[model samples]
Target: MTHNSIRVHYGKRVVAALFGLAVAWGTPVALAEPVDAANQYLGVWNYDQPDRADATDIATVGQFGINPLTFPQVGTIEFTRGRDGEIIGHTDQGCTWHFRVNGDALDLTSTDQYCFNNVIGSGYNTYSWHVTVRDGREQEVVRANSYLGYGTFDFELTNGKRTRADAAGPGDAARLFTGTWMFDPTNPAYLNNLTSPGYQPKTGAVRIDSNGTGLIARTDDGCTWTLDARGNTAELAPAGQTCARSDGTVTMAFWSMSSDGTHVYTVLNSTDPQLGSYFIGSGSLTRQP
Candidate 1:
């Protein structure tokens, strides 16, 4: 198989492992007050890594075929101030932890465990997080020990208080996405497997018209686009039209952009497993001048 195909297969396995780990971590901790000495860790803080992509170590594989390095950028983690003044953290990835903070040192242990049979084989796993926050930044160490193997990941964080503008609903699409956008070949979000045959272009440009229509090169000529004003999310799909792919005809294949209007977050797979092997690709696209 090709290099991209290998990555795609591994990527699927990694995603499965992430969900398994999240399920194993159990539910969020209930609100409680922390000791007088540990109240400083309260409130939501954002993970910040100036060199996140570069910091990720893809060489080592953890349990369930996951790489711990990418965890920081994948989801949000928020710490809320409990009524009693305790530090409680909730992660968008479905895990929660209770904090025991002492000055700059902190300890966090998972409240649950999960087992699964994955690419890394069948096994059970547990997690623990240790962190230190100071001087407008935090350093965190996550340890994942499983029956298969043990892995550690480090992350940094800074305050991420939302401003009045950020909390506001989506702005006009013409202002947010109607422009020239180019896909970044080096930072692909997802790629097609080799079994899926297609001309997967890594470098190309696309234009979103002012009236919610998209014109992309080397793919479907055009498609109807919709943007949710409430959430800055956008979707591009042929809708009623059928688009041709290398393996088969696709009518529902679409690309979904997250709240970030600048990047394409996901691309629906075009391949029909029962029909045969054919996969589509997805990746981030940056606006061009």
Candidate 2:
């Protein structure tokens, strides 16, 4: 099908026509590229360059070091269904790539380079990635167009151990926090009503630690919190700020996940009368690799 025709059919349902005469039994429907191979790479894969290459030195890889063929700057890659239902990847740094299964190999290329160039320092350069699944772990090869001309370097994409998310059974709220998480407790909005004039929202990563007891969360500014219990709540003291006449001080409380696993609901009581008292708000959280 033409690319334009495919784009037009995006998100549209294709109805199956049943055959009455012959029963086609046990044949699985063919799945589009990356989606079929999603299990091969959806989770985290530790990344490393053999002797520490330029890609590793320049880009931001995630905690588990996703994009092992690239850098160690710790970043994340999230997979979702595209308009055509193909596997689409979105990263924490704001880059998007698409994968297509070629024979027994999974091939992918960067479709969007926004974060790649901005955060990763890799410009419009498109690197072709071919990953082959082995008995235990998969092997990856990354080749730049420049390298293709000489036919010399197939910079081996570092392949590492892959880890999948833990299963938390049905109806468990803790499951929501099971994946990686972060939050910003220092948001100026956390300050009590008296000290600050308005409300500021906190930001950062949010995750439930392996022990299943600690809540690891952080903000964009790097302020971090590790909650030790399941139901405990704590008020945040704003980290001193350089913004207003005083160091930003925030007075906010944080509660654990509710039973349904949907929101990070919180109440912020600002010191500034103009901003009002006891502001209630909530944020939606998604699972991260």
Candidate 3:
């Protein structure tokens, strides 16, 4: 299957603008205390590099490719303040990390030892996260040194203006999908393997207003799209371009929000002969706070 690059010019512009604003605002205050930086880490963060293992060839060396020891290749990491004042880090894959801010960085250790062993590895492994707020956006750098190997991941997240999951009401469903959603390029579940080398996930957002009409933004190759919402389902399509499968069949994009509105299940199905008769891209999106 021949893959076409989606122009991501819009996302680039937004980042450039925000970076300028951050610079104009002067140097961000360096929080020497991890506890003091807790508030800065509160919110949902999307991975800047969705293809986790793509960072280095060694990443694909062993079971590492299929079994990553870090957060899912392409998903969201949500940080929230626990009732006890400890910071909680939640991954879309169902693992939770209890964070202790030690100044400039967070010391993360799994709360669910079982889930931790399953995703990361067995035995003791520690994760460190360093967060920096530029302008109004947040950037996180995570490093893990475990038996699997040492790896580092970076994330650049936009402020999605969302409340904590527990505080969200049912009515927020209509507005729940209104944030950035990314495709995991390395997740085999999200690609049509037979037809292409790999599908590059598009990074974008669903901007919904009170009036209910908004556009879907993709940052890969800068493709403009729009979205229509009805209840919990959102239908996405190219704004003015043609979206046809390899077999000449038209394609459509849609996403279904989970009941709690914290997760979004997405599907983009198309057809391609070499890539297979159908190209179905499936993944999850986490709401940003």
Residue 30 Cα positional deviation in candidate 2, in Å, after optimal superposition:
19
lDDT of 3 by residue, 1-289 (tens): 2233234666678778877877899865343755466776787654332323344101221233444322223334588888665788786444677876656655554422323433222233334455555554545544443343344322222212222332333345456555555433435533312222245443445433334453354433333455544334444433223344435533232222231256554434333324332323334555555
List the candidate numbers ranked by lDDT, top first.
Answer: 1, 3, 2
Candidate that beats the other on lDDT, 2 or 3, i.e. the better one? 3
Candidate 1 lDDT over residue span 218-264, tens digit each: 33334333322223334443432454545555443334443255554
- For candidate 2, lDDT tens digit of each residue in 109-209? 45332223332123333366565656634455544421222232223334432212222332242454445644424422223111222345444455454
Backbone clash total for model 1 is: 5
Off by over 4 Å in 3: 1-36, 49-72, 109-132, 143-289
Q: What is the C-alpha RMSD of each candidate to the true structure, in Å?
A: 20.8, 16.6, 20.5
Whole-model lDDT, model 2:
0.38
Worst 10 residues of 1 by lDDT: 157-166
Worst 10 residues of 3 by lDDT: 154-163
lDDT of each: 0.44, 0.38, 0.43
| Model 1: lDDT of residue 183 | 62
Task: Kindly give the stretch of ten consecutive residues in candidate 2 with the minimal lDDT sum.
Answer: 188-197
Runs of candidate 1 with Cα error greater than 4 angstroms are 1-39, 49-72, 82-86, 110-126, 146-180, 186-284
Count of clashing residue pairs in every prediction: 5, 36, 9
